[model samples]
Target: MAMNRVQFQSGLSLPAFLARFGTEAQCEDAVARLRWPEGFRCPRCAHDQAMAFRRAGTPYWQCKACSHQASLRAGTLMEQSKLPLRTWLLAMYLLGQSKTNVSALELMRHLGVSYPAAWRLKHKLMQAMLQDELPRMLKQVVQLDDAYLGGERNGGKAGRGSENKRPFVVAVQTDEQGRPLYAAMDTVPGFTRKALAQWLAQRVRPEADVYSDGLGAFRAAEVAHAHTVVEGEGRSRCEAPSLRWVNVVLSNLKRSLDGAYHAFGFFKYAERYLAETAWRFNRRFHLEYLVPSLLRATVHCKPWSEATLRGVPTFRTEASC
Candidate 1:
């Protein structure tokens, strides 16, 4: 019999993680390396003359240009967070190592933090992921489908009309061999032409071919490239063999959400979660660099407060992509 190798293997073991990031100093060093790999420069005045030291037990680089100080956690997602850098690094480690999902409850237990802090850290990393840029766009042949999370109502409509379900779009790009390469998922009001346009503009190329079921909203694909419509009623593309990898991706996403979260927080935060799911999916083949990549992204992204994530931002969720 042929052997089946596990796709998701551990890149950084627990022992390795503990050795490198067991202390605040180590975690701060990692962040400093990522944040200012070239050298410390005054973020405000573009001056490189700086002094490195610590205050309140946190490392700070004081710029001589204006005597302004910057910390590793400053101006990043870790800003304003009371949790130690070690805690933040460990949280990110657990999130990257898991192939299925990691609940905030589990994160709190493992990281030894309170539920509120764990929840905030989890969401903050997810938010940072939304700001991270994928290395490539979805191109070549792509499969498109409308998907939803949340359970059906006890006495309401079924399937797509079911109450409490958060509606979203799933698109998977495949290589010439019909294997999945990358994916993009985002929440939408409904599968409208405008929604598709907004999603494709950011994630896909104008020369790509898009395949979807018989939905009018998918007509938007024709605006730039080839669009193929498959009219298969009463069947889900998630299990259909034709789309193949797209089905596998959709199935795994729903399973991960079900396995990890209670209700995926609120529907308002669905886009953030969905974007995060897509990020993990696209990086599935590279399990090793996941944590470092995510941590780097957190450095690149601007700070997001609990207030910013509470309801909605001025940019709007649909356009946030």
Candidate 2:
């Protein structure tokens, strides 16, 4: 739709957003239009010209031939969710529009839900957004580095013996005009050649030029691509104009964790936050397009189970709750 920044910012207002997509019916109609841009076809029986009927106040489509029924929320992030469609859309807008970040507490106040419910909703939507905007493997010149997070108990020590405090995150990505692209972060026991190689192998595209500091762990990266080490004082080789950008990314991440979550236990969920930041950074110029594109993309991806969504082991007692 070629949504510019002005349009994106203005469109997010409750009144304006509701004006276009106010009611659940209107939102469902938009979803149906987006999902079946061509026409309605029975998902189960492949029947065309399905008749839609409201069952118990909810709209349902039934195939005339096979009588297969499908609800508007079927196969979507909204599927099985208790929250209203307008609320979900508003949350998406807040996530997209905010410059710093919106906290679960703030969202709770905004959506008028309980803290736990709001937390779960935010996490789930963040996961969906993460899945929606899976970054393409970075090409051309790529920058690599590692950052330590959550290690205050050991007097800010980053490596060994700080396991309980915070784990290290190995990051690799490119910077295009101050925006990070294709960034990937992995929790590691410590930053090492093996860990760096593993992260690179999984997230980086082979044959792309790689740049990094003069770290021996990054030496093996040359096997896959042209590697250059930017040495000398004050020379930040990575995407940022200086090493400051990485610090900024880290500070923002820490602030988000501190203000919203208030602990390091949610590190698993923190990855989704990083993914969200990466999505925002990559699509900063076209946020409106990005948001809707993500909403649309979530439809095609496989639905995440509650167990995975909660980040609990299937065999664990926590999952029983």
Measured by lDDT, the strongest candidate is 1
Write candidate 2's Cα lDDT for 1-321 as tens digits. 776554355424556666767788877777788778888878887778788888777778889999889887787766767777777777777777676567788899998988877777776676766665444466655666666555446454445455443344434354556444445444544456776676567566886777667768778787787887766544344334534455455556667656655553433554566666666665666654654665675555455656667673121111111
lDDT of each residue in 188-239, candidate 1, tens digit only: 7777899778667767798898888877998988898788886666546445
- State the lDDT at 96 in candidate 2: 73
RMSD of 2: 5.5
Clashes of 2: 0
State how far residue 45 of model 2 sits from its true place (Å): 2.6
Q: What TM-score do all the candidates reach, one by one?
A: 0.90, 0.79
* Candidate 2 TM-score over all chains jointly: 0.79
lDDT of 1: 0.78
